[model samples]
Target: MLRVIGKRLLLLVPTMIGLSILLFAWVRALPGGPAVALLGEKATPEAIERVNELYGFDRPWYEQYFIWAGRLLQGDFGTSIQTSRPVVDEFMRRFPATLELSFLALIIAVGIGVPLGYFAARRYGKVSDHASVILSLVGITIPVFFLAFILKFIFAVKLGWLPSDGRQSPRIDATHPTGFYVWDGIITGEFDAAWNAIVHLILPAVALATIPLAIIVRITRASVLEVQNADFVRTGKGKGVAPRTLRTRFIMRNALLPVVTTIGLQAGLLISGAVLTETVFAFPGIGSFLATAIFQRDFPVLQGFIIFIALAYALINLIVDVSYTLIDPRVRVQ
Candidate 1:
């Protein structure tokens, strides 16, 4: 396991280098430069040229990339053109919000998806199974943004059961020491703030969880069905093993490998998907921050954000790969 982890870490170096190259090229390839975004498009040609030279946009792409990459290696994620603040500072401020949202959404997805899937498989061809299948299909087919709107309208506007936007209600005077409202609220002994934070999270988390929940259900159902027919599972049953033990040990454990992989992939995607969800709910997170950066052509913010996301994805994959050994002893020898 140590050797495998070491190898994966080693591989991340080249992966990041390659990703950096593509990110650099793609951001530069965008139609407008920082100068145009900074100064109005009506700015004089000389003024724009001076702005380009000031930011070294006049330099060759390779030279610019190398300079930026060197700064990155030195732990300086460059200053944002729009905010004139360090990219890392801005990212850290918003990242916890996004992370908190994504974490909750995943919990909801896995909590509901896995059991629904397992039971659907156990009662295959029954009405319950068909209902699960139909629900999963609806989850996959519905667009997240539309669902978000519907949820907001019904729960927030019509029923007034939940807050529609932001992490907590403005009336709640809670201090966010760590940028995570729920945790901050609890540690401060402000239970109302904590509960309110949770209330605000429900609609958006459910909206974000929809697709991942659907995918996990389908994958879990298929994996369980396939594993149930395996020779080992049948052998365990034939040997008069307790039904519960047989299902848990011989069936679900083996089925979890694929399900785990799917989960890891979906978790990474959740970060990306949060952009639309965040926008709909007016949630303050890294996704909405980046969306604004794109329109403003904040190159440093854009570049730094992509690098952060790439590293996050790589680490998630690494963690998932390592977990396989723990889930199934058979994977340990391999």
Candidate 2:
């Protein structure tokens, strides 16, 4: 297990190196360039040259990459071209809200998706199975923006059951020490702030959960269906084991590997999908942060964010791999 973990951690070095190269080149390839973006098209030639030189766009790609990479190694993510704030500081500030929302969505997805999928597979060819199939399909097909708008209209505008956007009500004056409003509110014994945070969270969390929920359901259903027909499951059934015990010990135990893999990958998807969901809902998070960065051609922020995301994705997959040994004792890590 230690060896497996060591190998995975080592691999991240080369993976991040490759990703940084791609990300650097990709950002430079954007039209109008950062120079034109910072200064309008009407800006004089000398001004553009100065801006290019200031950011080292005047240097060779490899040179620029090494320079930026060196700084990154020292934990300097550089300043945002748009906000003029340190990339790390800005990311840390916004990350909690995004984490808060994405986490709730994942919890909701797993809570509802796993059981529905397991039951659907168990009652294959029944009405519930058919309904699960349709629901998963619709969940996959619906645009998050459209769903978000509709949810906001129904829940926030018409029903007034939930706030449409923001992490808390503007009328509420609460300082989120940790940037996660509800958590900070709870720790500080400010129940009203905590309640407001949850109310504001519901719509966005539901909208963001759509894709991952569908994906988890589909994967769980397929895995469970396959496991249910295995020889062990058949033996358990023939022996008249209690239904719950049999399913838990044989069916679910065998079915979880692929579902775990799917769930781990979905974490990355949730972060990526937040760009659209956050934009539609106007929730202040990395998605909107990146969006604003792109419009202003803030290459530093973009590079920092993508590298951070790639690192996160790699780490999540590593966690999933480690979990395999724990979930199934038969699986051994090198």
Candidate 3:
């Protein structure tokens, strides 16, 4: 297991190298250069040249890439062209909110999806099974932005049960020492702040959870159904095991591998890909930050964010791979 882990970790070096090359090339390929994006088109040629030189864009692409790569290796993500702050500092301020929302969404997805799926599998060929299938289909088909708007309109506008946007109520007084409002609120003995944070979180988190929930439901149901027909499951039934015990010990245990993989993939995606949901709900997250970076042609922010996302995916994949051994001992890595 340690060897397998080491191999996976080692592979990340080449993977990151390739990704950095692609990212550098891709950013440069965009239609407008940083100079044009930063200064209006009306800016004089001399002004544009100065801006380019200031950012070292006057250098050859190869030289620029090597300089950026060297700085990255030394733990410098460079300054954001738009914000004029270190990319890492800005990321630290924004990422916690995204992480919190993604974590909640994953919990909701797994918590509801797993049981609903297991129940559907146990009742296969029945009304409940058919209903779950339809529900999953709807969940999968709905666009996140559309659902986010509907949720905000129904819950925040007409019903007034939730805030329409932002991380917390503007009227509330709270300091986020850790940048995670929910945890900061709780730890600081500000129960009202914590509760407000949670209330504000519900709509966006639920909207973000929908697709992952649908995917997990389908994966879980399929896995459970397959496991239920396995030889060991039948043998356990033949041995007069209690129905609940049989399902729990023999069926669900064997059914979990695919479900776990789906959950991990979904979690990684949610952490990095909540742009549409965040935009519709006006939630401040790295997704929205990246979106803004793109439109403004902020190459440093874009490159830094993509690198962060690549690392996040690699780490999540490693965690998922390690979890496989824990979930099913029969599963072995060579």
Candidate 4:
């Protein structure tokens, strides 16, 4: 296990470096530079040059990358060109909200997806299975931003059950800031604020989760069906073991490996999907931060965000690989 972990960690370095280079070049290649975007059309060329020099954009691409990468290694994400605030501080402020929403969505996805898949597999060829398939297809087919808007319209505007936008009610004093409005509200004993935060989060979380949940359900159903026909399941059944016991212990246990892999991969996908969902909902999160950075052509912010996302993807895959050993003893590491 240690050897496997070491190997995976080693592989992550080059992957991250390649991702950073690609993102750095791609952001630089975009139509406008941060200076023009920030200074606007009327700004003088000299002004733009000064801004470029200040931000180190005047340097050679390799030199700029080395400087940025060095700062990143020292845990300094640099300052945002648009806001003049430390990028890491901005990230720290917004990331928890995104993390909270993503975590909730994953919980909802796994809680609902796994059982539905199991039932669908057990009832294969029946109406229930067909219904589950249709639902999963629809979930995957809809666009997340569109879904978020529709949900907000129905649940917030039409029904008047939830707040339309923002993390918490405006009336609440945001004195206690943990970046996560829900937790901060609770800690501050602001129940109404906490409740509002949770309500506002639901639409975005659901929108982000829809595709992943559908993918998980489909994958789980397929995996479960494959395992159900295995010799061990048949043997357990032949021994007169209870149907539920055999399905849970023998079938579900073996089927979980693929499902776990899917779930882990879905975590990475959700971060990308959150960009659109967060924008639609006007939620303050890493997605919103990245969108603003893109619009401003802030190469540093863009590079940092993309590299962060790539690292997130690699880390989740590593976690999934480690989890494999726990799920199936036969999965020997190294």
> Each model's number of backbone clashes?
0, 0, 0, 0
- TM-score per prediction, in order, is 0.97, 0.97, 0.97, 0.95
What residue runs in model 3 are displaced by over 4 Å at the alpha carbon? Answer: 332-334
Over 219-264, each residue of candidate 4 has an lDDT whose tens digit, in order, gives 9999999999999888898999998799778999899999999999
Model 1 misplaced stretches (Cα beyond 4 Å)? none
Report the lDDT tens digits of candidate 1 across residue range 1-334. 8998999999999999999999999999999889999998898899999989998999999999999999999999999999999999999998988888999999999999999999999999999999999999999999999999999999999999889999888899888889988999899999999999899889999999999999999999999999998999889988999999998988999999999999999999898669989999999998989898999899999999889988898899899999999999889988
Compared to the true structure, candidate 4 yields what TM-score?
A: 0.95
Ranking by lDDT: 1, 3, 2, 4
Cα misplacement distance, residue 214 of candidate 2 (Å): 0.6
Tens-digit per-residue lDDT, 1-334, candidate 3: 8888999999999999999999999999999878888898788899989999999999999999999999999999999999999999989988998998999999999999999999999999999999999999999999999999999999999999999988999999998899999999999999899999899889999999999999999999999999999998899889999999997889998899999999989989998879988888888989889888988899999999889988998899899989999888788733
- TM-score, prediction 3: 0.97
Give the per-residue Cα lDDT of candidate 4 at 265.
Answer: 91
Clashing pairs in 1: none
Better of 2 and 3 by lDDT: 3
- What lDDT does the true structure give each of the candidates? 0.93, 0.89, 0.93, 0.86
